[model samples]
Target: MTREAPRKRILLLTDIPPCSNLTAGIVTAQMCRFLPKDELAIFCVMNPHLRPMLCDDLAGIEMKTVRKPTELQRRVLRGIRVGRAGAAAIEAMKRIALPRRLIRQAIAYGRAVGATDLWAILQGQTMVRIAAPVARGLGVPLRVHVWDPLRWWLDAHGVDPVNRRLDLALFDRTLQQAASCAAASIPMARHYEETYGVPSTAVIASIDPALAQAPPPKLISDDSVVIGMVGQFYASEEWAQLVTALKIAKWRVGERKVVLMTFGHERPPNDVPDEHLRFMGWMDQPEVIRTLAEHCDIAYCPYPFAERMAEVSRLSFPSKVPTYLAAGRPILFHGPSYSAPYAYLNERGAAYLCRDLYPSAVYNGLAHLIEDSTLYEATALAARGAFLADFTLPRMERAVRRFLGYEGGKAGQAHGLEVV
Candidate 1:
């Protein structure tokens, strides 16, 4: 009897693209980078708006839209009949319940496309609950990647205590069903194990080396200092504190200014001192990277010091760190010392850690770095070296392959590195 051919089909279930530079998009892009483009038949189930973004160059991968009621449609239709509160309740129900329909559609698509493996990258708990039986029926392994439980929890609850409880229960149930699980960091992996009794592998979000090659530095005065922060600008109490710190820093430092490059919908307060604060509006990925490379002198990773933020710090690795590292710049991380990146930076001597969110500490740290050119360059070089060694695309690909039990004997040969 002839042996059956190895299955080459994969089903990737994720949110649609183009609106935000989320961790999900980053991981999906990384998967595209390493997965054998020619051999594997890929099918993506994503939001309708994201269809145009996943073009032909993605190794002939096919995309199918996961149809659901749009938020506006739901509000208009339900609010017209029912009260706004009732409509909102209905929308919440839909959010929790829609994944089942989405998964059924995914299963049908997978079977149609002859998929042998089911991979889920978003809606973790819901995806696991819905995809488990489908994978079992199809006799395929189910792989689930968890990036941030806090984000997922907040998304599910949104300040509703009852919904928060329901979300946690669902999250636990879904986590229990995953055949293989991956987390974004070591701390996250530990949290998964501790909370859900499931083993998970650490896989940080990766950067394409080609993209990591630095762009031409932006033109600025040699003596002018610019501290930069990038990514979303969701309003939070910590953000208010960040503004206060920046104000204090501006007062202390004569020539330096703080620049926030964001894709956030909300604008910074108009009254923020013009001399100290510069808000560069929404930038595309290339532009963001170029801005970071050319203009930034110090990278700020500031988040609120709250329970939810602490959970985020533990469970989610920051993608911006690699981007900053790639820019060959020093990072001023303002958060808990126990965070994974904080530990990593301390180990490498690449970041300055602050114990408190006080303005004085923030001011002092920024002042010292601005004055000490030797310290700044040394930290920058250390950060860049760390990225090249452990956080690049190739490193991530090998980790994913190992977690999938596909590590080859010659896998480390190209890098002249040994498998741990």
Candidate 2:
């Protein structure tokens, strides 16, 4: 007779704990759904100072938080006056010794809870180093959630090139052995799957249904067309092009006006003319979605088109897609042909897409939205369809659950993986 399998208990090791104040934490909370309280635990490293940022998102179940090794080491080094060699020695020693403590603590907790699975959240370096060794010691299948560009992430965190190469190698090995993998976007998942021949699922953390409702119809000004953008601003030149297009779309004796309204940022836009711009600085997300639905005629999404951003463009899907889709706004994509957002919207004919950076090209796309009512309705409908089809919290949760245990998960073997 076959022996019965043990119940699955997960131990998540991460540098960013699950909290509502940050995007990574919010996404992690979604992954926690459909699991029993006692079955999942979090062992995370966060700056104690950011404790105020913690919310009730993870109020129950088991959790532990520790300061990063570098944080602790820096505090120690400040207390003593050491020569360069001595300082380097002390720092290296602490780095080695502290990770040992983390490893021991992680293994102990895993054993205490009879953990059947090990999960790692890769936002930075420490967890990547710590989780793999601990998983090896625990004899459990390792599940990896990769949400950031690895090289970009490392570089952002001040990792030098030589060490970045070493860390990348370790990351590859860890990914190689993982029972399953999840990426932040479809392009990222495809790249990892092709490179490592491992099953990887694309999981975009999307809004709840309450936030996905279509905006109530409203009476827009007959002469004004409102275009809205939400979330963090990154591509400055692209935004300038948007402002320039708005200016260009003006004139022609009683032609309808085009207005650019933006939310979720506090900084004043650069050289925006008074007649064409509205900046609502940092509204709450629900309100932002509501505003997008009720008021805006079109939603704008852009990505950098420079050669330096090629990898990022190809791999990282814009998080704003879901927001725009959910709000039933027709997405106005301004980016290179190779970007993830461009490929996604272009493939479905779901948006008024512009491939060039010129103000005239951008204005033409805007004019299509302003002049063609059919284009607006059709594009919005297609975007909403994409949202319902792929981008939603429930869909994301299902993909993660399937990858975690539903199908190919076993106690020891991790070779054969099936995509959900």
Candidate 3:
């Protein structure tokens, strides 16, 4: 009898807590689902905080948690100075020591799971550092998923100068050591090539087939046109701009009420009129998909026009666009044209894009979409077509499979691996 080949083991190292509502977690779950189960064994890191939500059934997979050695100390310190100073101190320690701790724990977990054939790290400067040494030690290939450009995201999010510098250095070194890298967008791939001299494949996060296969129930209201958005609103300026644009659209569509329906956890600006906005709080994926399909007449995907956003926009794509497109609603892309979603969707006639970073541009785009039913239908159809052609789960899975060198049969299994 022919003997079966040994299954290659893959370790998925991520900063994200699995089974959460976060985009990275969802993407990681999909990656787990589509990878060749017969040829590969999957292992993932579980954040302690997400243990309660760990009910997602990932059969035949192994999971490990690396609790920080300093977690108790950090908690005690936090208890002592449970305010700004304490927070600053803990952040400093995390920046300085977290990478090493994560790496050590990852090594321990890797050994427990037997020899690993490859290391798969989700985007983050610290995660890259944690995975790189393991891959090098095991003589195995490492794959880094570039969800966002780490350097720019850190800078944009107000990371301290010292930590930012250290993280960037480590990030650069990690990429140099990586066997391959996958980016969320083509522009991101090109940026990696130009900036680090490392070629990358674009493996964009895409929509699940279950979510994309059906059209939402049509619930049109004669009195109001509901414009919906889902996800965290990280930038206040962007939210403020959106409110201003909504006001403008309200005026243009005289007598027709405009409602901004939002889903997810965030505090809306007090300045924006409460009557115009409806906060749905947080909902699960199924509810979100249902609301998008049945309730919304228009979908809004906004990126901030802040310096950090403009910088990172050239290097990453938003995971939310596929969801917005799958809703089969007219989409208003509010952000710089350079961003991947705006650029690609606008080029494909899938959305009405506001290239200029002004509320007037938003006003004009909204007015054009709201007033012309023919244009609205055409744009909606284009978005659905684009989602099917480029942003569906099957399409993404095929691309990722090719990138991982998992062609037909159990070919190109990683070799020369050693237990930690």
The alpha-carbon lDDT assigned to residue 105 of candidate 3 equals 66
lDDT of 3 by residue, 158-246 (tens): 55556567778888877776667778898877777677776578888776555763433332776677888888776566667768776
lDDT score for residue 256 of model 3: 71
What would the TM-scores of all predictions be? Answer: 0.81, 0.83, 0.84
Displacement of residue 107 (Cα, Å) in model 1 is 1.4
lDDT of 1 by residue, 1-420 (tens): 998657466666555431234545646665554555543444444444543444334635666655533433133463376555665687567666775676577777778878767666645334434556567666787777776763544553342444446656756766676666778888887778787776678888666565564422322445466777766543255456666776656544656445544433345653466665667765655566677777777777765566656677666777777777776678887767777887778888877776567777766677777777777777777777777877777778677765544535633332233333
TM-score of 1: 0.81
Model 1, runs deviating above 4 Å: 1-5, 17-23, 38-52, 68-77, 80-100, 124-129, 150-152, 155-159, 194-199, 210-222, 248-252, 255-287, 405-420
What is the TM-score ranking, best to worst? Answer: 3, 2, 1
lDDT of 2: 0.73
lDDT of 2 by residue, 1-420 (tens): 998767778898888777655656656775675465567888887755664355464567688777876532222355776654564465456546777888888888888878888888766666767878899889998888887667666655555445567668878887888888888778988998888777898878776665775632332567677888876666667887877666554532136766678876355466666666688776656777888888888898878776766777888887778888888888889899988889889877678999998888777887777667777778887877787777766666567777677655422212122223
Candidate 2's C-alpha runs over 4 A off are: 1-5, 47-57, 69-98, 215-219, 244-254, 268-284, 408-420
Choose the strongest candidate by TM-score.
Answer: 3
Output the better candidate (1/2) by TM-score: 2
